[model samples]
Target chain A: MDLFISLFINGLATGMLIFLLAAGLTLIFGLMDVLNFAHGGLFVWGAYSGIFVYTWSGSFIVGILGAIVTGFVLGWITEKLIITPVYGNHVQQILITLGFMLVLSECIKVVFGPNSIPVDVPSYLAGSWEIGEVIVIKYRIFIIVIGLVIFGIFQYVLKKTKIGLIVRAGVMDKEMVQVLGINIKRVFLFVFMTGSAMAAFGGMLMAPYSGVIYAEMGMEYAILGFIVVVIGGMGSFSGSLMAAILVGLAGSFMAYYVPYLSLAVNMILMAIVLIFRPQGLFTNAKEG
Target chain B: MRHEKYFSLKNLTFLIIIIALIFFPYVADSRTLTILMTQIFIFSILAMSYDILLGYTGIVSFGHAMFFGIGAYTTAILLSTYNNTMMIFLISIIVGMIFAGIVSFLVGLLTLRLKSHFFAMLTLAISGLFLVVAEKWRTVTKGNDGFTFRAPDVFRDRVIFYFFVLVCLVVVFLVLRRFVNSPLGKVLIAVRENEQRTRSLGFRTLHYKVTASVVAGVVASLSGSLYAISLRFVNTSVMSMDITLDALLMTIIGGVGTLIGPIVGSLVIETAQHYLSGLANDYPIFERWIIFFGMLYILAVIFFPKGIVGTVYVKYLTWKSKKAKPQLPTQSVPLVKDKERFE
Candidate 1:
């Protein structure tokens, strides 16, 4: 029972981290129909920049803020320079974004040097709580709380805000939203920036959670994010959360029980899902 | 009906090129150049196989390395465990191609129905699964540590190996060209242009796509076998994403839809990589050659989206048409008379 509880918590924490990355990916794909392969680059940048700030300023809050800012600036540049030209062409978008992804990864190696950096959990969130036989780690709980709070905040904003209405409308029918005289282009830029910020935010959080940050981690986690997005359904917010949790739990349990099949498990799950639900589990029926 | 001419300028150019390549080893005594040329031939075959999907069929797969790795591992295991004879090598290549074809056929049926984005991600995931299996199956694969093996007696000589690979490249290229020019190839092109229209016309686009996937997979496996034989080694890195990306880069840089483009692309890329990495000894900046590669990739997509061969072909056509414009006035008089007669 103790092992199960700890495993469950571990899965939930990892799920939240994946959700943070997938959320942005889904939103960007949903609203703009732009598959940003370079999203991973934004992620690693966030980890590096945020970690740099954290060490320099000796404040985690400042690091998080710095990461978000880096995401925004990078997102804006990527959208304007790389994505704007290949807006409607999927092939061009894939090729260009992949190129940009390579550039982003190489740039990280250039700036941070070609070594993985070890990250420490801050003093305030270091210990664990013991309840009978169950010992709960504080950092894991902190990540879960942060994920839930962010999810709640985003849900509130998406449900109630004017920008949320426009975004939802854009996702449904961009032409219809444009017919209503909204500048859909601006909305695209705004959504791209927000999604990138979320990815960077996830990266910043993941750095300490994993205890080591590397340039290549972006690609590794980005694949996880892509899997979550596919399982969850493109552009479906709640679906992403649910699918991410499912994947997280599956990965955690598989690692413990069938160690050899740990990595293969995710691919198997994705293949099963693809076979059954081509449109994805959470895809809107109308869209399908 | 009048038969088409067989000895056109294009045919002559190709024949000359083939003849020149057949004698290349004799003239070029430099062992490094011979090896480099051999590597280019192998990669060119791989890139051509990719072209059948990305260029002819409009499918973008990120898991092409899986087939390549399958070919390499099959040959490696067979030659190392059993007799290192020509017969075993031949059987291994055949087995690898068949295995790749079956896997690609199944993968196509499962994921080709999804949108391009889904297909790309699923292929990547599937390839990653293959990588994991290769890494963990240490008993057979020897895992990431990898193992080296002796080549067949015939391929032990570098000159013989070079000629052998050159013949394979030429044969594969000619076969693929004929495949693309056939009626079935035309249907594949139609499917790429507009799948719904092709389906509405009762072509069953899925069958054609699966066929292309299998063909591409088979050819890619052959290249993989050749690559392993050339190196006389096998490793899990053969299944890595980098191999797939290299193939993708080669296809894109040469030309997507052009059969000859991939050959040129492999030549440009292989030479560039060799020289750039070699230059790392002298210039410290060349240590990060991938950054330069990425920049070149981005520029290619932005400026030369059609690729080197594709853009040049387009330019040649436009020039030919301009040159023929003077003869158009003579033909216009008949059209004017036809209009007058109709009125």
Candidate 2:
């Protein structure tokens, strides 16, 4: 029971992180119709920049803010320069975004040097809690709480706010939304920025959770994010959270039980999902 | 008259390139250039195979390296075990082709009918699955350390191997050219242009896609086999994302859908990589040469979206039409017209 609880918490923590990234990816894909392969680049940049600020300013809050700000700026620039030119062209979008991904990853290496850097959890969040035979890591709980908080805030905004409604409406029918006289282009840029910020924020949180940050970690985690997006059903927010948790749990349990298959477990899950539910587990049927 | 002119120019360029490649080994006589050119031949084959899917059939795949890796590993394992070059080479080609065919068929069946991005992602996952297995299956793949094998005497001589690879490349190029110009290839173009309409035309689009996938896989595996022989070593990198990306880049850079364009793209990219890496040794700034390549890639997509050969081909057509009096559209002209949208 203890082992199961521990694994479950571990899985939940990782799932939350993946959900943060995938939420942005699916949202961007939904609204902007851009795959944004460079999403991973934003994640790694957040990790590196957040860690850099944390190490320099000695304040985790400042680091998180800095990372989010960096993500927004990068997102704006990428959308204007790289993405705008390739709109409505999936092939060009994939190729250019992939190129940007390479450039961003390489830029990280250039800035941070070609080595993985270790990061420490903030002192207040360090250590663990023991309840009977179950010992829970405090950082893991913190991650889960933060993830849920972000999800709740976004959900509230998405459900109640004007901008959120517009965004969702845009995802459903961009032409129709534009016909209603809202500058859908501005909304696209805004949504892309917010999505990127979320990805960076996830990376910032992931740095301390994983205890080490590297340039290539973006690509690694991006693959997981893509898997989550696929499993959750593209353009479905709640589906991302659910699928992420399932993938997280599956990965955690597989690692412990079938170590050899751990690396491929997410991929296998994706394949199974693709085969059985090609539209994904929770697709927006109306759009499809 | 226009058809004759176009064919003569294309034929002339093809003949010149083939003759140059045939004589390159003897003319250069430098071992380094020979090896480099040989690598180009192998990759050109790989890129051309990829063009069949991306350019001809409008299918985007991210797991082509799986087929290439299968070919390499099969060849390595066979040679290491059998110690007979002729039999091992023959067996590896057949086994590699079959293995690649089976995998592509399964992957195509599962993902091809879905939206394009799903197919791309699933292919990536499938290739990554193969990569993981290749790394973990220590008893067979020897894991990440990779394995080495002795090649037959024929392959030992760089010049003989160079000519051999060149011949294979030319043969593959000619065959693929014939394929793309055939009636079936036109159907593939129609599918690319409009899948729904093609299905309404009573064509089994899925079967055609599957056929293209198998053909591409088989050809890619052959290149992988040659790559293994050239290196006398096989490793997991042969099945990596980088290799797939390289093929994609080459196909895009040379001209996506044009059979000869991939060869040009491979030559350009391989030469760029060669010189760029070499420059890194002299200038510290060039240490991050991949950054420049990334920038170049972005710029290429923005500016030269049609690719070098593709752009040049368009220019030639424009020039030819300008010289001739405006005439009624013909079949060949319409085919060229269909390709213009990619630009």
Candidate 3:
């Protein structure tokens, strides 16, 4: 029971991390139809930058803020420079973003060195609570809480705000939104920035959770993000969260039970999904 | 067809290149260059195979290295166990190709129906699974520290190996060219241009795609076999995403639909990589040369979206048309007459 709970929590935390990355990806992809392979680059940058600030300022919150800022700025620049040119061309987008991803990852290596940096949970969030036979790690709970809060906030903003309505409308039909006299380009830029910021925020959160941050982590997690996005519907937000949790739990359980097949389980899951529901588990019927 | 005879510029250039490649080993001063040329040949074959799917069929696969890796591992395992040189090498390549074809056929059946990005993503996932299997199946694969094998006596000679690989490259290129120019290839092109239209026209687009995949997989495995023979070693890097990306970059850089473009692409990229890494010691800036490589890739995509060969081909056609503009006056006069009569 204890093992199951811990594993469940572990899986949820990882899933939430992936959801953070996938949410931005799916949103950017959903609205803009841009496949930003450099999303992973934004992630690792956030991890490194957040960790740097955390060490410098001695506050995790400041680190998170710094990472978000970094992400927003980078995202804005990327949208303007890299992504704008290849709009509506999937192949070009994939190729250029992949190139940019390499640049981002290499730049990280150049700046921070190629070594993985170890991170620690904050002092307040370091210990675990023991309730009878169940020992609950504080950091995992913190991650879950943070993930839920962000999801709630994101959902609220998306549901209630004018920008949210425009984004949702844009996702449905850019032409329709443009016909309605909304600036779809501006919306695209805003959404791109927001999505990048979320990815960075996820990276920042992941640093201490994984206990190590590396340049290559972006690609690794980005694949997970892609998997989650695929498993969820391409642009469906709630689908990403659910699919991420499923992937996370599956990964965790498989790792413990069938260690050899652990790496392959998600892929097998993806393959099965592709065979049956190629559109994904929770895709909005009309979106595609 | 009459325009593409021995005197044509295209044929002449091809003949010249083939002749030069034939004589290269004999006249070359450095053994390193001969080895590099061999490497280029192997990669060119791999890139050409990739072009069949990406260029001809419009199927962007991310797991192409899986086929190449399969070829390498098959050869490696066979040679390691067996002392008979001819038997093992031939058997390994044949088995590798068969295995790759079978796997691709299965994979295509599952994945070819997906949207472009979904297909690419799924292939990546599938390839990642192959990587894991290769890394973990230590009993057969020797895991990360890949095993080495002895090649037949004929292949041990660098010049012999060079010519052998060159022949393979040229043969594969010709075969693929034939494949692409065939009536079926036209169907593949049609499918690439508009799958819905092709489907509506009563063509089984999926079968054509699967056939392309199998052909590509077989050719890629052949290259992989050559790659293992050239290195006398097998490792996971052969099947890594990097290899797939390298082939992709090569195909894009050269010219997608042009059969000869990938060869040129491989030559350019491989030579540049060799020289760039060599210069890293002299220049601190070159120490992180991958940044520059990435920058170049981005610039290439932006500036030469049609690729080098495709752009050149377009330019040649425009220039030729401009040169023939004097003849168009007669044609336009008739059109003018027709327009006046209609009025």
> By DockQ, who's the top model here?
2
Per-residue CA lDDT of candidate 1, range B1-343, in tens? 2244799888899999999998999999989999999999999999999989888888789999999999999999999999899999999999999999999999989888877788888899999999999999999999999999999999888999999999999899889988988889889888777788999999989999989999999999999999999999999999998899889889888988878989999999999889998998998667678888788888888777768887787777667768877232211110001111101
Ranking by DockQ: 2, 3, 1
Candidate 1 residue pairs in backbone clash: none
Flag regions of model 3 displaced more than 4 Å: A284-288, B1-3, B326-343
lDDT of 3 by residue, B1-343 (tens): 3234668887788889999989998888679999999999999999999989988887789899999999999988898898848877899999999999999999988899887888888999999999999999999998889988899888878999999999998899889988988888889888777788999999999999999999999999999999999999888888798899889888888877778778888998899889988997998566677787788778878777656777787777667778877322211110001111101
How accurately is candidate 2 docked according to DockQ? 0.54
For candidate 2, write residues A8-47 as lDDT tens digits: 9999999999999999999998887778889999999999
- Where model 1 places Cα greater than 4 Å from the true spot, the runs are B1-4, B326-343
Q: Which candidate model has the greater lDDT, 1 or 2?
A: 1
Q: What is the TM-score of chain B alone in each candidate?
A: 0.93, 0.92, 0.92
Misplaced by over 4 Å in model 2 are A284-288, B1-9, B326-343
| Docking class of predicted structure 1 | acceptable
lDDT (tens digit, per residue) of candidate 1 on A1-288: 999999999999999999999999999998888888889999999999999999999999999999999999999999998988777777677888988988899899888888999999999998899999999999999999999999998898898999999999888888888889998899999999999999999999999999999998888888988888888888988889999998899889888889999888888988888878866788776774
- Candidate 2, TM-score of its B chain: 0.92
How high a TM-score does candidate 2 get? 0.95
lDDT of 2 by residue, B77-127 (tens): 998989847777888878988988888888888878777778878888999
- For candidate 3, the TM-score of chain A alone versus the native chain A is 0.98
What is candidate 2's CAPRI-style docking category based on DockQ? medium
Residue clash pairs of candidate 3: none
